[model samples]
Target: MSTPVLGNNKRASCGPGNGIRQNSLLLFLLLALASCTLVAAQQPPYDVYPEAKPPYYRVRYEASGKPGELIFPVNYTVWIPPQCETLRGVIVHQHGCGEGSCKSGLTGAFDLHWQALAQKHDCALVGPSYEQPQSADCQMWCDPRNGSDASFRQALTDLGQQSGHPELSSVPWALWGHSGGGHWAGGMVMLHPNRVAAAWLRSGVPLFEANPDRKSIQPHELPEAALKVPIMCNPGTKEGVTVKDGRFAGVWPANQTFFAEVRGKGGLVGVAVDPLTAHECGNQRYLAILWLDACLQARLPETNGHALREMSLEDSWLAVIDGKTATAAKDFDGEPLSAGWLPGERIAKAWMQYVNDTNITDDTPPSAPKEVRVVDGELTWAADADLESGLARFIIERDGEFLANVPEKSQNPFGRPLFQNLQYSDTPVQPLTQMRFAIPDGDDPQSHRYRVFAENTAGLKSKPAEVAP
Candidate 1:
């Protein structure tokens, strides 16, 4: 389904007539805000969901414009962690342009893996859907200087009041965006650098230089303030010139220009090229989450509300390409590299493994399910959580025969499968702890044997726990 695009009504007259119309529009917006406040006060806070599905909190805010003009509306959905009492920051996962990606925004907040990251940092996960049609000008909202930025700030205030957390307006932001959404995220950092903790721009960035041919996109100015924010530019390898006529060919040039300008200005920036498919997000989150985790730990304040501690460069390592092979560089000496300044040794190793194979290399499996018992065809067990990749799902086998998988959910359009125990879809898989699988009734009860195996997001399966009936 496509989001309806509302058109603005223009006045034929200029001069005094235009002035009068502008003033009327401002008055109308004020009235609208007041009305929204009244309605919000009467509405109850949205409940947090363990699985992906509807019933999430969403608020629509109109961009500022002349009265009677149909301003673009930005629809925002926020997922607050059920356990977090005080939020430290907020992570905004923005989708690309077009109908499919815009619709994907509905599920971004429901992602369980992102929720885990947010929960660890006491942050809220939010997604914004700009109601721009497929053929519409993406610059209308992607450029933060436009009214979308104002609408986003307003939405935060509205949600803060609705959720009874007024501090939401003051907390820092960790932005993660794809395609045109990347342009939005990157633009946001440039516009409001101090308020942002970090940014991950995937396959898109706002152009600092204006192209006379493309006037639709207003060029953004690179401000000195943005130099402090940590940013990462991730583009697919296939999007480069090597592909010649690839569909996403523009991605590499944009990333190169952006990275050069930002890094040349002494900004904290890095580039991590996806070795796999072009334009498709494949196994990037495995590194994205870890990178964000390190950035947040180094940037966020302690419990007493002190200044953030600086990240030590000495602890970081660089990964560079030597001929056809990938090599780790302990020293950073202004050399051309693939991944520059990995946070730590573990992350450095993970980055190397990822770049070399286009997947996270994790041989260690999750802890096996414990106390597995079957009573009256009902199975119950508990498994130790895998701290590395996080638990994806549990494999159940009956007498060495494949049985049902717990919490069946569909995979997201992104690379992650639903069975991976991550939120790729709007509906999340039910928690494994609360899951109960019914055994087949026709099976021989005495001769039946059940085995349970825990799988991590890396696709590693743990040792099985066997139970005899």
Candidate 2:
């Protein structure tokens, strides 16, 4: 089964168009990426082992996509925590090479294990199968196009949407895979680091040969910043059997090579070497969750949230705001609070709102160009236009001038939020005029400073605001 490629009609088009046209083209490309084939209309609840009496189980919504095309069907299994309201995190299980079978394949035993894990962690587990090939053709296994990265992503996305837990957005996620699934886990770490918080690979093969250029250009290459992400490799003590000539052949290396590679790159790599164990699912899983618990317990920095440094308009700098002790955020609403109010405070509302919208960008211009203002207890800008449509880019200006252009689609220098479809959520227009930014907080609040600017096509820039400290 192959990942789904979107129909041409679903794609964007352009013919000698301007910035707006170009932006549309970008949107099209992003949407085309949605071709990931993990589509199964969620079904009503049902029992898995209806006849099993009190200890019952069921994979509620299990269905393949429209038949015909290379159908890489992924099963979406939900492991609801006993206390759904107070959830810990999301766990994703990627299946390895096997013909589709819930009983005999990776999906079978994992469904039970995932459910147990979810119960233990007070979270949810979603196991998705990325085309576990029935045959191991060298060409097929080696081809990047043949991999299940897209299907895996789509599966995770579908799970998130259906689970309907707002906390999932905040909760971290761990990627677990065995054998071929492990290889895909590596790909996920390299390609979608922003979507995953950590990963554990159990006896998986290296899908890609390590190359310097591929390391740099490959969309899935591990980013330098991702060195912080935790990784684990639990290769079986015994070598895995290599299939040859349509038969199970010789054995391969039992060493934890990928574990070493990840460790070399400054990642926290866990290794459960040769523990008097056989090459089976049970052993691999034990190592996976043990590593998960350790990594998930750490308190990570809120790189993009409210706890970060604040931005000030004075010199286009970001500062940290320490409001930890406040019952609720101190109100700088109607009445201006001293020290925190920065230059771009006027446009801060518009900028922040644009970034947080969890929907596709309409790519339209703001209708009523209203300046930023603090209304009620929160900051808000009353723009008459469709504020959500315009393009947004983060401007890193040293002294009221452009320094480097950072596309929002750029990797989150951290390993969390793997498979992040942040780009798909909002279509950003290029050459933005008026811009807003959040201020970073720090131990010494006075040390940070930054400003926000709104630029127009006439080369006119909006007055910078002193971001509230």
Task: Give all TM-scores, in the order shown.
Answer: 0.73, 0.43
TM-score of 2: 0.43
For candidate 1, the lDDT comes to: 0.62
Error of 1 at 9 (Å): 31
lDDT of 2 by residue, 219-273 (tens): 2345764455556555433333222211111112322334444555545443443
**Candidate 2 ranges with C-alpha deviation above 4 Å:** 1-71, 86-88, 100-116, 130-133, 136-147, 166-171, 205-220, 240-256, 299-469
Instruction: Please provide, for model 1 over 131-218, each residue's C-alpha lDDT reduced to its tens digit, 9 standing for 90 to 100.
Output: 5544445556666666667677877777777677777777888999877778889999989887788888876777777655445456
True-structure RMSD for candidate 1: 11.0
